[model samples]
Structures are given as C-alpha cells and as structure tokens.
Target: MSAAKIGDINLYEILGVEFEAEQADIRKAYRKKALECHPDKNPDNPKAAELFHELSRALEILTDISARSAYDKVLKAKKAAEVRTKQLDSKRQKLKADLEQREKDASYIQSYSTVPKTDEEVLQEQIERLRREGSKLLEEEQRLMREQLVRTMLEHQYAQAKTSCDSSAHRIKLKWKAEKDKSNGGYSYEDLTIFLKKYGEITALVMSKKMGSALVEFKTLEAAEMALTYEKGRLQNPLHLEWVSVPGVKVANETRGSILDYEDLVMRKLRQAEERQRLIAQMLAEDEAEG
Candidate 1:
C-alpha cells in the first residue's frame, strides 16, 4: 500500500467500512478484511501481504482516540488531493483523445484528397516500370517451375527409398459425387481393407461421414500417384480419387482433365504475356524517340 497505484484505494474503501463507523464496527470490519487479504489465506495473491499490512495500519490508527483524530485530518486532505488528481487525469485524457482524432482526420485528408502532379517523363517512366514488374512476375513463375521440378525429383527419391509409408500424407481422401447406400454401413475394418485393394495396394482404408469421404493410405507413394491420375472413375464405383493434401476439392467432377488441356493453358498465358511485353517495348521506344 506504500507503493504507487496501491494506497490510492482509500483505507475505508479497502476495509469496506463507513467513515463514521464506531471502533467496535471498525474492528469487526478489519478482522473480516484482514482474513480475506491475509497472506496465509491467499497464497496465490502476491499483493495479499501488502494489503494485510495496510489493513493493520488502518485498524491501529482508527482504534486509538488521538491517532484516529490525527489520521482523519490527513485522510480528509488526501481525499481532496485524490479527487483533484482524478479530475485532471480525466481532462488530460480527453484533450489527448481529441488531439489524436484531429491528427487522424488530417492524415486521411492528406492521403486521399491530395494527388501529386507528374510530368510526361514520369508518365513514360511509370509505363516502363510496368514492363519490369511484368518481367519479374514471369521470372517468378519460371523460378516456381524449377522449384516444382526439383521437389518432384526429391519426393520421388524419398518415396522409393522409404519402406514405411509417409506418415504425413500417406492417405488419399476421396469423396463420392453421388448418394451412397447407408444399408451397408455395418462395414468392418477388414471390409474396408478389401474394398481399397481394387484401387492398387493400400496400407489402410477408413470411411468417415465427418470427412464426407473415404481415406485410403497407399502401400507405396507410386500407388497414391496412380490413384490421383484416375480423376474419373475407371471402375464401377464412380468415386474419383482426390488427395487429402490438395487444399480444395469440395466435389470432384466425373470428367478428367487431360495433360494437353494443361499445356494449352500454359501456352495461352505465355502468349498473352509476350504480347503485352511487345506492346510495352513499342511504346517505350516511341517515348524515347520523342524525348
């Protein structure tokens, strides 16, 4: 209670007793407050010892006639000072909040309302800058392709070397596009094992309603790879395989996408990017000649 932000809680407030309380009433309140704030009673509370000491001091001053009168005069002066301190804090906080609001308003106006003017040279520079940005994107895409290739090689090496299945993503999660028969819900673990054997060899197969699909762990990574290729149903089940590792596939289509389609997409994007670069170069050359 001698420390800052501690003794600010008035002695009367801490004891929760009225200012005009008699010695007997004050004594009773002190005992209750002391018991509640006692070091022995509150082992978890670090502030219990300080509060107990403060309670003892309050009781000592209030119990004695001379000490009580002296303490009352000091308490009255402290209360007046505390009130003034609180009023000033509140006023200062209000002024600080208003200043912050004004700064925020000024910042918003400066950011959105005011636009800087640029010359023809700046415009040409901006146009030229876009070509570098576009080239960077294309370069990033190439880097990604190289990384993907290296990753594929490393994954292939790891899969072939390891006898035990990949603990992380050994399982292939696939959802049925159509309604399944619930009558055959009484399937055992052994039955699931037998069912998954149709799609290459698997370590385990688990069906879950919560997952909304069947999770089948391939015996080898090659098996999982083969299963992924079967986007459309090869057999009667009509349930196309999708890897759990794939982020999104709420519902996989019955139709499969060919490698040719993927290649065509890459070609289209490359052509578009090249066309853009050609236009940019032409514009930059004309700007340089004019300048």
Candidate 2:
C-alpha cells in the first residue's frame, strides 16, 4: 500500500475492530467493510475509492499477527508518553504561577514596610549636615589665620633691619643695590602690574626704552619700603625701586603700554560677559521646553 494511504487512516477504526481485537475478528470486520465500500460497486462515487484503499491497508496489517502486535505496543507506549508529558507541563505551570505570586507578595511587603521620606525632610537633613561641616571648616580657617598672623609678625621682625631708612645717601644707595642684587631681572612690565595690584599702589611709574628699567613710586615711604623689603628678594624677576627724593614727578607711563590699555581690555571683558549671558538664557529656554 502507499505511505500516504497508510498515514491518512486509523487502521483499527478502518477495520471496525478494537485495537486489542484478534486477527480473525479484524479480518472479518475488514472483509465486510471492503465489500460495502468497494470501488468496483460504486465506480461513479469518488469517496468510495478512498474508503476501499483504507479497508485494504487495515486488513493487510491486522491479518499479519507479528505486525499487529508490534503496532499495538508502539501505540500503547505513545499514549502513555503523551499522558506523562501533559502531567509534567501541568506541574511546571503551577510552579511558575506559585513563584510569581511569592515574588509579587514580597514586592508588596517591601513597598509598604518602609514609608518614603518627603523631599523637605531629606533636604533639611542634608542642610543640617552641611551646616555642621561648614561650622567645622570655619573654626579650622580661623585657627589657620591666627597661626599665619603670628608667623608673619615673626618674619617681619627678622627682616625689619633691611627696610630701615639710612642717614647717608651712599648708604641708602648701597641698601637699594643690595636688594636689587638678590632678584632675577627677567619679568616684563605686565608682571609688575599684577605685583602692584597685590602688594602696594604705584604712585608714579616710568619705563625707559634705552635702559629697560621700571621706576615705580609708592604713596608713602612705608609702602615703598614694604615692597622693597618683602617683594624684592622673593621675586624671581628683579622689581627694584630707588627712593628718589625728587619732587613734581607724578605722571608716569607703563612699560608695556600696548598690552595694558584700560579701554580695550574693558570692552573685551564686557563682550565676553554678554556672550555668557546669552548662552545661559538659551539653556534656560531649552530646559523650560523639556519641562
């Protein structure tokens, strides 16, 4: 018989016999059906051809005792395996549902057990902690300031003699010479402007193109003396000042006049400030749109 014909029909049902029926009973049932549904008797009916083929295959297999017994055993094993698979699938589904329920219960318990802190409470706690830390920092800063003041007083006392005014003109020049000798004269006029801003006011200043030496005058002798005493020996570039007793010499020019124009620098700074404000406004607009 054809493989498709065998594949399409349940052989036991085609024979009209139980799966456990004897070979004789199977043969009897198949003969009766084969005669009833014979293609030769119903040549005009197309379905009679299919039923005849089924009956023939069923009779052929069932009539053979060995083939019938082997087929019965295979069918029994297949059915048993299908039942076992269904039981295993049921167990798996039940276990999965139980695990999911346990996880959900655990999540619910965790959510309810701890109440979330409010934004205000959290912010207040952070603020108080920061305040405590700031107070500690302030105490440390005050202590450091006191210590620094005491150290500065001691250094000032030690270096006091170098800054004293002398009676002899030659001795005063020698003192200025000694202070000048201690510095490295490599800094530009721009460097002096920064130094003056920090240390003392420059009352009168002059820079000569030929000598390249800067002459700076301070408001008081003490201010000039302080600059000569403290900054003279400390700077790598020699920034020295001689105590000229001349009068009516107030107008002075900066050494690097091209680089230190007040108008040009102020304009550049204002332009930068405007550009920064424009960028900040653009960022705020983007944030508002997103919100």
Candidate 3:
C-alpha cells in the first residue's frame, strides 16, 4: 500500500485497489467500479462514459505483466525524485538556521566581552565618565567667567575715562596715535577738526605729517576727557588716543594710569576660584571613598 498521489491520477486508484493488490483483486475492484460508471447504468451522467473508459484502460495495463512492470518502474522513479527534492530543501533550511545561530553567538560574545565583569569595575567606569563630564563643565564655566570679567573691566575703564579730568595739565589736549597703514588715505586737518569738534570745541589742531599723528587742544577739559573715553571704546589697534604729556598733570583717582593691568588681576582671581573648586572636589571624592 502507498499514500495517494497529489497531482497525476494513479492506475491503482482508478481501479480502486492498493498498489500491492494481486491481479484477481485488481479485476474485482475494476468490475465493481465499472458497473457504477457504465453509460447504460448511469444514463444522464455527463462524465459516466469518461470514468468507464479510464477504468477499462487501467484494467488493461494492470492485467498485462510487461506493461504493469514498466508503469511501476516509472512511478517509483517519480517518487524517488520527489523524495530527493524534499531532502535538499530540508538541508538548505537547516544550513540557513545554523548560519544564523553562529552569527548570533558571535555578536553576543563580542558585546559580552565589553561589559564589566565585576561590580567594582562597573562602578569605576561610571565614576570616570562622571569625572570627564564634570571637568568639561568646569572648563566651560571658567571660559564664560573670563569673557564676562574682561567685558566688565573694559566697561569700567571706559566709564572712568569718559568723566575724569586732569585739571592741572598745561593744555586740555589729547594725542592721537594714527598708524601709517591704518590711515586709509591720510586724515586731513579739516577732517580732524570736524571729528574732534563733536567732543568739544577744538582751540588748536596740529598734524605731524611724517609721524601720521595729531594733537588737538579742546576748549574745555571735560571734552578732552570725553574724547579720551573713546580710547577704549572704538579706537583700538591702528588708532589710539592718550593724554598729551604734561609735567604736573593732576591725575584723577579713577583714571590714574593710562592703561590698567586688568589681565593679571583677572588671571589671579580665576586661579583662586579654580583652587577652591579643586579642594571642594577633592573633599567630596575623599568622603565618597570613605563611604
């Protein structure tokens, strides 16, 4: 006996007998099936003649020993081919599953190797990460502090220079330092008078053509001081202004020096601030270690 074929019709099935049935059994099965399918017996049935014809052919093939032998060999070969195809498909699926499992194992091992093995090691990694973040934040804070301090100092200096006056100076004059390369085209005497007149009435204007410098005497001391404030405001690198040298000039308390040593002061303050933070951090770390 065998399982039924899925696609093509089997001769044994047409005769309504098992594959291993004897010739007598096959003939008995065919006789019974033929009676039910004969055109005369099943008149008005459209497929009655077709079914009877197929049964007759199956009986003819199975009764002849040579024909049955040939047909059995062909059926067996087809079954063998189907079995080999199924086996190949199963092997391909197994190979794919094995490959996927190996890749999964390799990835797991790689990731597992990077993980800290001990609780202490994991704690240390976390501490190191926190330390790096803290240091970055501290550095950024210092940078912002430095910029703010510098800006504040510049503003203070400008304010003092704008208001303070040296009453004892022989002349209320300001010296303009104009670098040769800075002058787009040399500034004219008329240009200086027009520009300086805004700060105060200019009593005298003298230009040193060779040196590319100018000296202006204001009508009042307040205007000269106001003009001096611009020294820190906009007249930077190539252009600068300072009080003209006077032997017994009365320097105001706030505007004693031409330039302040603000950079050194700012640096010292920053260093002290950093030292305090460092000590605090050290104490925290020591407490953590004790805990």
How well does each candidate superpose onto the true structure, as a TM-score?
0.27, 0.28, 0.28
Candidate 1: the clashing residue pairs are none
| Local lDDT at 143 for model 3 | 50
Give the alpha carbon lDDT tens digit for every residue of 1-291 in model 1: 221222334667767789898877877787666655667557899998888767765665456555455455556666775676577777786886688699767766776555452232233343344334443432443355445544444444343333332322445665554334553333445645655666667765655543224566676566677667754442544555776554222111201334443343334434543543454455445535643
Please report, as a residue range, the 10-residue window in candidate 1 with the lowest summed lDDT. 247-256
Q: Which residue pairs clash within candidate 3?
A: none
Which residue ranges in model 1 land beyond 4 Å of their true spot? 1-9, 81-291
Report backbone clashes per prediction. 0, 1, 0
lDDT of 3 at 60: 57
**What C-alpha lDDT do the candidate models reach, one value each?**
0.53, 0.48, 0.54
Each prediction's RMSD over C-alphas, in Å, is 29.3, 40.3, 39.5
Q: What TM-score should be assigned to candidate 3?
A: 0.28
Off by over 4 Å in 3: 1-7, 90-291
The ten-residue window of minimal lDDT in model 3 covers 165-174
Model 3 residue 159 CA deviation in Å: 99
